[model samples]
Target: MANSPQSKKRARQLVRRTTVNKARRSRIRTYLRKVEEAIASGDKNAASAALQAAQPELMRGVTKGVMHKNTAARKMSRLSARVKAIA
Candidate 1:
């Protein structure tokens, strides 16, 4: 229960932020899933393209505070390596 006006305002802000963050997270996951599907289909070129497209999205998630910097970096590194190995 938000008794104070400030607390009520904060709760409202939190709800808004949560919705935005959820959308961002879902968008990032969609990008990652595209990359994964491309990889699974054994198409190196498609996988590379998907990875390239996803890289910025993942980085955007980091910048937006949806994900950690190192977490994004590690994901990019592993995905790129997998894409490279597709050949």
Candidate 2:
């Protein structure tokens, strides 16, 4: 029940932000999933390329406030390590 005009405006803004954030989160997940699938397929080269592509998108999520920085860092680190270990 946003009675005040400001509150109503804030609610509207929140809805907009939520939609944008959801899209960004979905995009990030898609990139991560690509890496995961490549890893699962045991294609080291493909996994490395997917991870390379995903790293920036994940970091962008952090920068855009869709995800935590350390969370992104941890994901990138683990994915990179896994990519490296895939021989």
Q: How well does candidate 1 match the true structure in TM-score terms?
A: 0.98
Q: Please, what is the TM-score per model?
A: 0.98, 0.97
lDDT of 1 by residue, 48-80 (tens): 999999999999999999999999999999999
Candidate 1: global Cα-lDDT? Answer: 0.97
**Reference-based TM-score, model 2:** 0.97
* Each candidate: RMSD: 0.5, 0.6
Score each candidate by Cα lDDT: 0.97, 0.95
Residue 39 local lDDT, model 2: 95
Predicted candidate 2: what Cα RMSD to the true structure? 0.6
Q: Per-residue lDDT tens digits of candidate 2, residues 1-87?
A: 999999999999999999999999999999999999999999998999999899889989999999999999999999899889888
Candidate 2 total steric clashes: 0
Q: Pick by lDDT: which candidate is best?
A: 1
